[model samples]
Target: MPARARLCATVPALLPSSEADLPEVFGLPGRRLLAQRGDSALVVQALDDALVPSGGSVRVPAPWPRRRGTWAVAPDASLAVFAGVHAVRAVEPSGATRWEVRHGCWYGACRELHESYEEYADSKDHRYPEGGSAGFSVDGTFVWAHVRGPLAAGELGPDVVDEWLLLDATDGRVLGRADAGAAAAGSFHLPHPSDPRQMGLSIGEGQDGAPLRWGRWDGRTLAVEYVEGDLTLMSVSPSGERLMTVTHDQDALAVRDTGGSVLEGLEWAAGTAVPRHPDAEPDNDEALPYWDWAGGFVDETTLVGSTVEGDEEWGEGRHWIIDTSGARTPVEVTYPVTVGPQPPTALGDGTWITPAKSGEALYVWALD
Candidate 1:
C-alpha cells in the first residue's frame, strides 16, 4: 500500500542576507532557522517564526581558524563544527565548551592531541598534526577521524596513505588506530548510523585497494569490512535495520541488510528527464543528472530523496519517493530549486524542511 501524504505547512519566502551554500536544516519541531550565514560563518538559531531576528540570534564561535568542511548536530541539538586543519570543537547548548580536540594527520606533519575542557577557555583544543578528519557518533559519545599519510605541504599527492582513529568523547583519547595505507584517491568517511562504533571509509579511484571499506569497532578490537562496488554514500535507515547506499557506476539505489546482504535495487527511470525551463536553449545535456540519493526510509520499503537532474536550466531539483515493495514507479515531488534540503525529520508527516543553500533562508513543504 502507498503511504498517504499530507500538506502540513509551507514556510516560504524566508530569505537570507548573503550568498549561502551548504544549508543544513534540522527539524527541531518548534526550533526555527538554525543556519549559518556564509559571509560571517555565524551559526544562528532563530527562536521565533518571524525569520528576521526580532527574537535575537546567537553567534557560534568558529572552532578552527580556517573555513572548510561541514557541521553536524547531535540528537541533543548540540553543534559540532569541523575546521579542516583545526580540531573538532563541541559546543554546548548553553554556548559553552563541552570538549575540543586539535586533530592532525601524519601527512600534514603536525603532532600532539591538545584537549581542553574549561582550561583553554580562550584557545581551541588541538589534535595530533596528522591528516585525519573527524566524525561524531549519533549520540555524540564518540568521534571517528581518518588521517592521511605523511608528506610535506604540497608534496602529498592524491595517492598518499592514511590511518583511522577512534576516539573517546568524554576525553580526547585514542581508543584504537588502524593502518589505512596507500591509496590512489581521496577518501570520504561515513559513520554507521546503526552501530555507532563503526564507520565506512571510502577511498576513491586513487587508492590501490577496494573502493569501499567498512570499519567496525568492537570495544577492544577494530575490524575492516569490505563491500563490492564504488560506493558513493552510505546511510542507515531510521530503524537501523537496513543500509541504504548509492553507487558511482550506476544511478540505481541499493538497499542492503544491516548484515551486508542485498535486499533490493531501484534503478533511476531513464526517460524521466529533468524538466527544462520553457525559455532555456535546447541542448542535449540539459537534463540534469539525478545523483546522490540522500535517502532515508519513509516506511519499511519506501525511501525519499532530493534529486537534481543534470541539466543546468531545468527544474528546481525534484523529490523522488521510491517504493521498494516490489517493482514500482517512484512518486516524485517537483518544486522550485529554492526548496532547501528535503524534510529533515521524516516522521511520516509528509512534510519536510529545507534550509536555503545560503543557510539564510528556510522552506517547509508538505507533499500533495
Candidate 2:
C-alpha cells in the first residue's frame, strides 16, 4: 500500500518581483533562510520552526543584477556573498562592502578584471556569461566558492581555468584553493550538515556532463576528492554521513558515503520498478520513468523523491518514500492535497515541502 502524507504547514513564498519568481528557501544546519532577490538588493529572512517567516529581514545591497550569479547568506543573516561575473563580493545588511575577491572573468573570452559590473553590463557577450556559486560552511566561519580561475594576482597558469576556494567568511581572506579541472557552465556549493570542514561542489557543464567534487579544509590546506562525472550532489544526511545524488540523465538515484562510494541505488525500467502511467493513452508506447534531479533524505534511513518530470505528460506527478536502510525500492507517496510538478524537497526534519497550486505558498508534509 502507498504511504500517506499529511499537511503539516503552509509557508508563503517570498516574492521580490512577480509571483512566479519566488525566492529560494536555503537550508542551514538546523535553520532555514528565505533569500529573496530584488532589483539591487537581496532580502534574507529567517524561517521559524514551522517554516513561517520570523523576525526582521536583512536587505543587502547586491553588487550586480540577480541574474548575473548566485548569492549565499550567512547563518545569522548578517552577511551576503555575491558570486558574480568578475568577483566574489561580501556585503552587509547596512549597505557596506565587507570585502571582495576578484577572479578571472566568467565570460569565456574576456580577461579583464573590469572593476565594476557596469563595464560590461550591456555587452552582448556578457549577457549570458557562465557563472559560479558560493555558500557558507555549516558554522558560517568559512565560505566555499567555485570561480573561473587565474585568481587576481595569484600565481597560476592560464590552463587553470576554474578553482574552488576556501575563504575566511569573516574577512574574505583566501585561505586555500584547489583546481576544479572543469569547463563549467555553472556550479553550486553543498555545505556539510555537521562538519564545517567539509563541503561539496557540483559543476554543470551543460550537455557535456556534471562533475561532483568534495572538499575538505583543515585550517591550513584544502584537499579535494573527485567523484565520478555526471552526478549532481543533492543533499547530505542529517548525521553528515550519507549523500544523495542523481545522474545527469536523471535515470538513476543513489545514496553515497562521504568518500563518494555508492551504497545503494535505484534505476527506472519500463513497466517494472516504474510502470507506465495508467492515464497514458492506451495505444501509446510504453513510457519509462526517470527520477527527478531533486529530492533528499527525510532522515538517516528514509527519503522522499519524485518521478515528476517523467510523469508530467502522462498525468499528475508521482512521489515516493524510498527506504535507504535496506529494501532499496520506492513506495509511492499519497498526498492529502494536490501536489505540483516540482519534486518534493525534504527538510531533513521528518518532513518535506511541495509548492502549492497557488504558486504563492509551500505545503509541508509529514507521514500520516
Candidate 3:
C-alpha cells in the first residue's frame, strides 16, 4: 500500500550574492536551511513549522572557492569555517580571518607547508586532491575537523596519515587530537544534538572501505572509538539513542544503537519489499533495486528512504517510509507532484526536502 505525502512548502533557493552560480541548499539538524552560493558567500536562514523562511538570511563571506573543500557554519550563524587543502580558516561575516591553522598538504606527495592557495591553485596535481571536512558543535563553542595528519613539524608518523582535531571555535586553538587511522579520499562530521562533547566522523577511502568513528572530548583529552568498517553513517535519531546506516554496497539499511549494535536491519528483495520495475523486461535479471546513500530518521520509530539510484534506469525514482520497531516493512510513499531523481533528504523534523527539477527551488514533504 502507498502512503500519501503532504506538501509542506515550496521554498525557493536563496538568491546568491555571488555572480554566475546557482545556490545550493543544505538541511541542518535543527529546522534550519543553509544556502550557499559559489565560493563567494553563504546565507543561513531559519524555517518555521510550515517550512518557510522565518527571518532575514545572514550572509557571510566564504574564505575560498566552493570547489576547494567542505565547510560548516556555527549554530548561531556568527562564524563560518573552511577546511581547505592547506589550512582550516575561520571567517567572519565581514570577510575578516579570525584565525587559521596550517596542516599537512592534502596532496598525497606534497610536504611543503603552503601559506596561500595560489601556490598550487593552478597545479594539475592539486586540481583533484583528496581533502577533509569540518563542522561546528551544537553549542557553537567547539569545532571538530578531519584533516591530513601532522599538525606541525616533527609530528608525523608512518601510520598517521589523517587526524581528527578538536578546536576552540572562538580562537581556533587546538585542544585535542586523535589519529583517524585511515587514508581518506574525503570525510565529514555529524554533531551530537544535546552533547557538545561528542561527535561522529565518517571517512571514505574510495573503493577501499568506509570507516565510522565516534569521538568524545573530556575537556582535557580526546578519545575516539572505531564504530564499524563497512557502513556509512546516515542519521542520528531524535533522542540521540539510535543511528541509521546503509551498507557500503547499498544493499542493506540498518538501525543501530549509539554503541554500534544493530537493532534492526532490512535488505532489498525485488518482490518482497521493493517491487520490480514495471519497465524492465520480464526476464531481465539486470533490474535490481539498491538504496540511496542518503536519508535519515523521520522520527525515532520511523524513517523515510529511497531506491533512487536503482530505479533511475527504468523511470522516475521511488521513495518509502520504513517502520523500525514493527515488522520492519517498507511502505512506498506517493507524492502529489513529481520529484527529481535525486535522493530525498530528511530534515530530522517530521519532514524531508527534495530538489525541484529546475534546480532553482526545494519542496518539503511530510506524511499525510
Candidate 4:
C-alpha cells in the first residue's frame, strides 16, 4: 500500500536577501537544514520539539562578495567553507577565520578573487560560470575540496585543469589530490553519509546536465571513479548499500551497487499508472513520466520520485514512493496537504523536507 504523509512540523527556510535563486538544502546529520543561497546562508535545524532558531540564526558568509561559488558546513556545524572563485576559506561559527587556501580562479579571465561580484562576472573568459565546492567528512577529520587548478594569478592559464583535494580540516594540509581533466561549466560536492574518506563530485557540461566523479581517500591514495557515460550519482542510500540516480536526460532512475553494477531500475518514459487521484485528468491519465533530478531513496526498500511539474492528475508534480526492493511495485504517496514546487529532500529515515520559501517555512513530512 502507498504510504500516507503527515505534516509533522513546520520551520523557517533561508530566503535570499533580495530576489535571488532558490536555496539549496544540505542535511547536517542532526536533522538540520542548511538552506544556502549564494554568498550567505542560514542554518535552521529540526529539534526535538520544533525546528531550531525559528527566526534563523547567524548568517554564514561567503568569502566573496556575491554568492558565486558553493559553501558547506562542517559536521558539528562549527565551521564552514567558502569555495569561492579564487580560494577555499574555512571559518568558525562566530565568523573567525580558521584557514584559507588561495587557488586559481575557476573563471578564466578573472585575475583573482575580487571583492566586487560584477568585476568577476563581467570579466569572465567563458560565458558559462566556473566555481568550486568543499565538504567535511562524516567524522569531521578531513575536508574534500574541489577547485579550478591553482594558478599564481588566480586565473586559468593556457591549459587549465580542475583539481580535487583531500585536506586535513585541522591545518588545511592537502592529503590527496587529483586533476579533473574536464572543462566543467559548474560543479558541486555530494557528501557520503557513512564514510569519511569518500564523496561524489558532479561537474556540469553545459547543456548536458553534469557527470559525477566518485572519490575515495584511503589514508594514502585518492581513487577517482568514473564510468565514462551518463551515471549522474544522486542519492547514496543511508546505509551506503546503493546509489540511486536518474539517468542522463532524466530517462530512467537507476540504482547501482557500490562496485558499480546495476541492481534494479525504472524508467519514467515507460508509461506509469496514474495513482487514483481526485483531481486527475478526465481521461487517458496514463502517460510518459519524467523523474526529478533531485529525489532519492526513502530507505533501503523505497524510492521517492518527483517531477519538475505535475500533470493535471498529480497536481503540481506528484511525489511517488516506489518499492524498489522488488517485493512490490511503486505507490503514489498521498499527502495530507498541498505540497510546493521544489523537489522533496528525502531525509532517508521515513521523513523528508519540503521547502516552501515563498510560504516562508519548511514542511517536515513524515510517512505513515
Q: Candidate 1, which segments miss by more than 4 Å at Cα? A: 1-20, 26-59, 77-83, 89-133, 149-160, 180-195, 200-212, 259-261, 265-289, 306-309, 313-316, 335-351, 356-359
Q: For candidate 1, lDDT tens digit of each residue in 273-294?
A: 3233334455755343554435
lDDT of 4 at 298: 72
TM-score of each: 0.65, 0.93, 0.92, 0.82
Indicate which candidate wins on TM-score. 2
Once model 3 is optimally superposed onto the true structure by TM-score, how far is the C-alpha of residue 340 displaced, in angstroms? 1.9
**Clash totals for all models, in order?**
31, 0, 0, 4
Error of 4 at 120 (Å): 3.3
Worst 10 residues of 1 by lDDT: 148-157
Cand. 3 TM to true fold: 0.92
Number of the candidate with higher TM-score, 1 or 2:
2
RMSD of 3: 2.4
Candidate lDDT values, in order: 0.50, 0.83, 0.79, 0.66
lDDT computed for candidate 4: 0.66
Clashing pairs in 3: none
The TM-score ranking, best first, is 2, 3, 4, 1
| Order of the predicted models by lDDT, top scorer first | 2, 3, 4, 1
Would you list the clashing residue pairs of candidate 4? 39-67, 105-154, 280-313, 310-317
**How many Å off is the CA of 221 in candidate 2?**
1.1
Which stretch of 10 consecutive residues in model 3 shows the poorest summed lDDT?
Answer: 16-25
